[model samples]
Target: MTRFARTVAAVALTTALALTAGCGGSDSDADAGSDGKALKKVTYLTSFGNFGRDAYAWVAKDKGFFKDAGFDVTIRPGQGTGGVIPAIVGGQAQFGPIDLTGGLLNMGNGQAKDFVAVAAVQQHTMAAIATTEGNGISKPKDLEGKRLADTPGSVVRNLFPTYARLAGVDATKVKWVNGEAQTLMGTLAGGSVDGIGQFVVGKPTVEAVTKKKAVLLPYSAVIPDLYGNVLITSKKNAENDPESVRRFTAALLKGLEYSLGHTQEAAQILKRNVDTTNPAAAAAELELMAGYVTPKDGSGAVIGSLDSGRVAKSIRLLEDAGTLPKGMTPDQIIDFDLVPKG
Candidate 1:
């Protein structure tokens, strides 16, 4: 062959290799500064599918919060505590959300240890059992003999037995069927399931999709201390790249504050990125969630502030409920030093 031909082949091979390497691996080589140079690429997963309840993450990306923090974020749908923890541990994703109660349960049983909670997204647990008007479900006891659809390993599904015991419902009587995160509400709308696992904020979306008023049974009503969603990252990232975690957590909470304050705009921002999101429904969900996003009392604590005392109490609550095993400390799951205080 000719020298020119060999040179051309070499150039093509080099170009192909560069492109492949760029897409395949994480780009964590640069300083975790907001200088906007050599942006570190990372993957984030929502607490669930692209529902309005998880809109803050999208808002962070769309509003340049992640970018401003020197991150090139790729957001994906999460399957809840069961799925997000493993993904972060396995290096498949860098940041995500998971229900704190579920996280505690996982940590208590020693099934999870490689991920840490960085920030609280919603101060109160929003897990609920939702159905339309015709579902004959006005209270938890009504859930008996009903079918519910939800993602496997979802917080709602994992914590239901505890919720059931507290609500005086028969856990064994209700049936839980596996459904994709994106399609759970649709399954409810189509009447394939009597109910769908949801957040209290999801009422508006369920109503819009079913064109019927939604009936909700919030777990918070019975299990008061559970936290809804908390931002998380792998232990390696938290230890080796503490600055990145701090920056990412700050940006995400900023977006959370912005989304709750400006619901319509936040909803439109979410709708722009995810076509399945309805602006009006998204806005309503955000509005419903506003009360749950901050300090429930008049104390004026910051949105993501978490108390070790409260978390310890939460652990005991789970232990009594038979969901979490004995002996899980707040330190096992939370990084108090990294948590936002101001």
Candidate 2:
């Protein structure tokens, strides 16, 4: 099994042991319920294995937002967005914070029609094409005829066609080298591939592996309507447990706001939960991700607010790129009511 799978299994085992030992008391035992009852237990699955990327969730639990909301929340590391959908659908998790593109693609293709986005955490796409300093690849157009380390089923690979279209690059000519996620950066730094499509949040990791600064060409510059991480749950959960969903969204947004304002403290909180050995790097990653949770879009929307127009534009963009089927409206994929109001 992958390291992420092992970690998740370990956490599950520990939670089971704690529950068996009577240490895992319900929320009522801690006076966290609204009606003198135990708060509901909610499990959140992340999109990837990176602990640094999931700082908001860790901060929420650390700062007692979940407790205040009457929830005994547990956060687990995920293998990928692709695996996150099934976990939620199969009732393994109550919610998932995943790539919006993956959710949209799955819903649009009728793979998981019940899936809906509760709130958008990142306003813009963080995916970018990174090249080593002397690779001579500075722009999207430069990617033509060059080799890219592509991971199958990755959001970056899924959205590359749309990105290429918007950037006016000929996608047909680019050479894609299928590479494992763990080895992609090493392969790129070793001159095996000219560039790699990954999230800018991973810039520090890339630099550490390559021992050199990497140039980033953000996909958002080409596809401005693109979005990033989102809080997702099935329609059944939203409809059946509206109050619980509301509380969870509010608590998560509270954590996001705190993380945005206090990045260092948030990173420290995250470090305690995940295997992030480099405190400075974790802080840097959190700082870079903070601006994206709620961008300075003039819409006046708060942290967890979702703009209908932007959501529509994103759907249209995906449809145009053929990633999503035409006529698939945003309402079919996103439950706007689940987001907290201003």
Candidate 3:
């Protein structure tokens, strides 16, 4: 079998679980009805803040796509992947928009056995390892032995270790620190850490605070496993509530389409959805996110469709780098049937 076929086969065979995540209880009442008709409630746990999920959150809520799709979608933000899977597995939510790599690792570790990936949101890694220009960490190699701050167990956490190893730098050589999204710039400014893994959206804030340019560490360059935020539903949902899964994914894809097509309007929506403390950061995030918007060909067909070939490459890279265990194939972990085939 081809490598891609092997991966598909592998993901199909795995009996993995998801990590149990915690979050603020969103509407403890399970029977909350939809706007017009009583539709099932679907919880979507986000790994980032309101600003991070602005694209989907605003477009879906403001555009009424979720309601139109017959879902009372509830949005809940999380600190990281630690809260996403549990929010779903523990019945706090029905879906999680989380880091693909962390979700897979959690599955392998048996924290959430029933979770399945439904759709991919962004097409690129929207994060970077920012450093001050004067700090002398100009190139990727300069990161060796530097104080690196990152949130442990986050997507960038898994990505950067592998990236460091790939860059010929020992992952153990650098002092890796756990950091929060709100306090990363402060950490860098205070010299607590020489470099930080920051989202592309926060680049402006980091630049403004430190007066230094950052060396972006694009995941695609080092890790073949660079997958954007993914929509995941429990295996129980996939089997028993396929309709809800379909509705959620369809609505989210609609939101993504609208977000990409209406840049000006989407930006405005983003502004309202996020807080005022980081308007510039939020705007920069949206602007930088433009680079990741999946484009349509001349035939008017979106190219955002799942690439099984890329998935296969990701599996191999993970396995080769020891991020994943040996013999873990794509099929055992992934369910392409949940994704739109056409």
The local distance difference test score of each candidate is 0.76, 0.69, 0.60
Which structure is stronger by TM-score: 2 or 3? Answer: 2
Ordered from best to worst lDDT, the candidate numbers read 1, 2, 3
TM-score of each: 0.88, 0.84, 0.81
lDDT tens digits by residue: candidate 3, 1-342? 000000000011111112121111222332333545665666666555454234455567567677677766666555566567777767778876776777766766666566777776655555457777777786778777788887675677766666777777677777778876556666787777888766555555666666667555555566544676677777788889787788778887786666655645654664454333244444455555655545323533242355666666776777777777666556555567777555
What TM-score does candidate 2 reach? Answer: 0.84
Candidate 1 lDDT for residue 89: 93
Candidate 2 displacement at residue 60 in angstroms: 0.5
Q: What global local distance difference test value does model 3 have?
A: 0.60
Report the number of the highest-TM-score candidate.
1
The Cα error of candidate 1 at residue 162, in Å, is: 0.6
For candidate 3, what is the TM-score?
0.81
Model 1 spans with C-alpha error above 4 angstroms: 1-36, 297-300
Q: Model 1, 1-342: lDDT tens per residue?
A: 000000000001111211111221222244343674767788888776666666677777777777778887777767678989999999989999898988887777778888999988878888888888988999999999999988778888989999999889899999999986666766887888999888887776677777899898889899888777888998889999899899989988988888877777777776666655567777777778777777756665787988888899999888888888888889889998898885
